[model samples]
Target: MTLTTALALGQTALKLGLICSLTVLALFLSYSMLNVCDLSTDGCFTLGAAVGAAVAICGHPFLSIFAAMLAGACSGFVTAFLQTKLGVESLLAGIIVNTGLYSINIAVMGGSSLLNMNKTTTVFSMMKEALSSTPFAAQTELIIGLIAVICVVAFLVFFLKTRLGLAIRATGNNADMVKSSSINPVFTTIVGLCIANSFTALSGCLLAQSQKSVDINIGQGMVTIALASLLIGGTVMGRGGILKRAVGMVLGAVIFRLVYTIALRFNMPAFMLKLVSSIIVVLAISGPYLKSQWPQIRRRLTHKKGGI
Candidate 1:
């Protein structure tokens, strides 16, 4: 390729990278807060979009976005309650809630499988009008997504330092320990799930507004995607402070998106997207475990050399 073409492609890749990273960061925060691999993300995402679109269609675009967030929080709350109080398995609870959300999302859309917001005022539309009238609409979405990601990251960073946030983290790390300290682990779980689901819902709402529509299946397998992003970020960023991990998760999300985009560009079958995502996540989750064993292996090799 010519130099100019190469530069253009590079720029495109960078933009795509930014988009993916921000997305992953959002997922990482949600998952970290919930302390569960929330399957509800799949349905809650669609619910957010549907609610946001419906609200926008009714001339309350901003309120619709907020409503979408609230809806998502409720979904998380249900899952948390089921898992904590009803003693349901976290995964099964998430599935049940997800299943129920499918019908609820349809109901929100008045029984339609999809809702278009072509003429509806959306969050991005207002942002475009308020910020700039540029034709590069995707740029507007990027800015908004970035801002949202940054805000969440900052909030989470600060939150983990607070008493409540530490309690939640402690609950996730060791429920018995937290409970033994006279703190209610159940409440922590509920609050964490609520925060996580709220972020996921916000992502869904923004996505719908960005696309100007909502498809019922838009969030299908979203939990996997989010997990992939989190894993990728964690692997690449390495473990340290809470802030580092959170930032890494976001970076991982961007990396996952870039890999997917590249696969698509190579004419890879769409069906393989999820397969690739799964492989990436598996590798990422295994990285830390493998690293931990490296020192032992190195010591063994050193002893063998000395014996030789």
Candidate 2:
């Protein structure tokens, strides 16, 4: 490619990278706090879009975003209640909530499987209008996404520093220890989950507004994607303090997006996307284990060196 064409392509890639990174950051917070393997993300994501689109279509774009957050929070509460009160397994609870939300999402779209918001009053439209005179229209979404990610990262960092936030993290790390200290782990779990789901919903809402449409299956495999992002970030950044870990998660999401974008650019088969995601997750989750094993090899090598 010519030099000018290469620069243009590079810029496009960078923009896409930012979008994906922010999205992953949002998902990382949801996963870490909730301790919920939320299959419901798939349905709730679509639900957010449906709710956002429905309201935006009626001329209230901002309201739609909040409405979507509410919908996601409710779903999280139900799953938590099922797990904590009804003694349901976490996975099963997520499955039940996810299944129910699927229908609810469809209903929100007027019983249709999708709702097109093209030319409708979406969040992006408002943003575009506000910046209409600027040449930044083409890069608006990327800029907004970066800002949102920064806000989310800051919020999460501040939250984890609060007394309640510390308690919640302790509960996730050690339920028995929290219980011995006279704190109810269940409460922390519920609250954490609610927060996580709300974040997920917010992402969905933003995505819908950005795309100006809501499709029933738009959220399919979202949980996996989120997990992939979290793992990628954690592995690369070395999860440390609350702020660092949170930031890492966002970076991981961006990296995940970059990987996907590169794969697509190379025209890799669609079927391999899931496979690649799974591999990334596996590598991320197993990173610590691999690190621990390294010492054994090092010890053996040292012994041989001394003998020689």
lDDT of 1 by residue, 258-306 (tens): 6776676678987897888788777777777889999888889999999
Q: What shift in Å separates residue 236 of candidate 2 from its native position after superposition? A: 1.7
**All candidates: CA RMSD in angstroms?**
3.8, 3.6
Instruction: Report the C-alpha displacement of residue 123, candidate 1, in angstroms.
Output: 1.7
Model 2: per-residue Cα lDDT over 1-308, one tens digit each: 57876555555555544544544554555467645576677777777778888988998987887888788788778888898889999889889888999888888889899788888977678788888899987777777777767777788889888988888778767767897997787888788777777777777877777777788877777777778888877777884897888778777776776667667667888668677887877777787788999988888999889942
Model 2 regions lying over 4 Å from their true place: 1-27, 286-308
Give, for candidate 1, the lowest lDDT window spanning 10 residues: 14-23
Q: What is the C-alpha lDDT of each candidate?
A: 0.77, 0.75
TM-score of each: 0.86, 0.87
The 10 consecutive residues of candidate 2 with the worst lDDT sum are 14-23
Clashes of 1: 3
